[model samples]
Target: MRVDGLQDLATITRQLREQRERAEAEEKARREAAARLEAERQLFSRAVGQVHPLTDRNLAELPTTPPEPLPLQHWLDEERVLMESISDDFDVSSLLDTDDQLSFRRPGIGVEITRRLRSGHWSIQRQLDLHGLRVDEAREALGEFIRHAHKLGVRCVRVVHGKGLGSPGKSPVLKGRVQSWLVQKKEVLAFVQARPIDGGAGALLVLLQPARSA
Candidate 1:
């Protein structure tokens, strides 16, 4: 008698054979699609190769066009005119007034800070030496250095302007200039002549105001 629910071996074999046939058909379709795509690529390549190639003469005969001038030229010209109109005079005596040792503090700032700076109370975080630089170069360097130090929240710094022994008459030209520049900067809270161990009269210890949180 036949079983109520179980399939016979012949029925299972037939089902497997049908599944294998379906898989083979799908594989054959995929191969045909790939072959068609390769043929189309070959046709496109041949068409591209038939187009004319350009020679050196064709490239050489092309128009020689200059790039457009920058729009900043107008602004630079205006700046030049403005600079030319300004006077090139200042009170030399005011800039050169440092009595025995270099020192200065802005209004409302205590003299104790300058004393502490001179006595090496603060650790020197950075130093800039203006030994061989020209006046213009020194000024630019000093301004940039101070601004950068202020931005980085640096509190104490040293500036070595040198004794200027090589200058004519052995006068310390940069020393006075540095003192003048430091006083003018808003970031400079106080400055004093360095001690003997810190370059003495040749260098200065500067105290910078802490950068305000933005």
Candidate 2:
């Protein structure tokens, strides 16, 4: 009986020791995991410095209205009419004076008008520079300018059709064309080569008829 009691006591002592050891190990593991989690949180805090949330006042408003549409068809019609009104085939030599400037005066306009134009009797109200423009472009622009100026009662204007030093043969390309175009327009009364102060051979001083009362 005494030997059996001793064996039972030894087994109970061993079981208690094992339970204590397991509890100590679990506590150590829990502490180590908490320390690691705290270290990781500190590292993240250092990397992300600081942050700020945007407020409603900082937001931008979007545009509520659409842009105006272009008058594309109207422009196209105007360009077409301009193209048809002026002719490149019009002969201007018969209308020009025999002077060195090759000035022109409409029928019944008289040589006095050309002389007045050459002497700058009328102030140049507007000027169109056709340098570097293609032939078709220059023609359209010239037509539009002349019609507009005549409509607004502009008496005189300058048309600069560059001396054409850049052309294939160093000849002025738009000079003859401009003269012909001017002769065809009823609005043009006379045109004289610009004087030395106003671009010399590279431009013309044109006189437009006063606009009729509406």
CA lDDT scores, all candidates in order:
0.81, 0.91
Candidate 2, residue 46: Cα displacement in angstroms equals: 99
Best candidate (score: TM-score): 2
Residue lDDT tens for model 2, 159-187 = 99989899989999999999999888889
- Report the Cα lDDT for residue 132, model 1: 94
Query: How would you encode candidate 1's per-residue C-alpha lDDT over 152-187 as one tens digit per residue?
Result: 999999999999899999999888778767776778
Q: Poorest 10 consecutive residues of model 2 by lDDT? A: 51-60
Q: Which stretches of model 2 miss by more than 4 angstroms?
A: 1-84
The Cα error of candidate 1 at residue 212, in Å, is 1.2
Error of 2 at 119 (Å): 0.7
Mind sharing the TM-score for model 2? 0.62
The window of 10 residues in a row where model 1 has the poorest summed lDDT is 84-93
Clashing pairs in 2: none
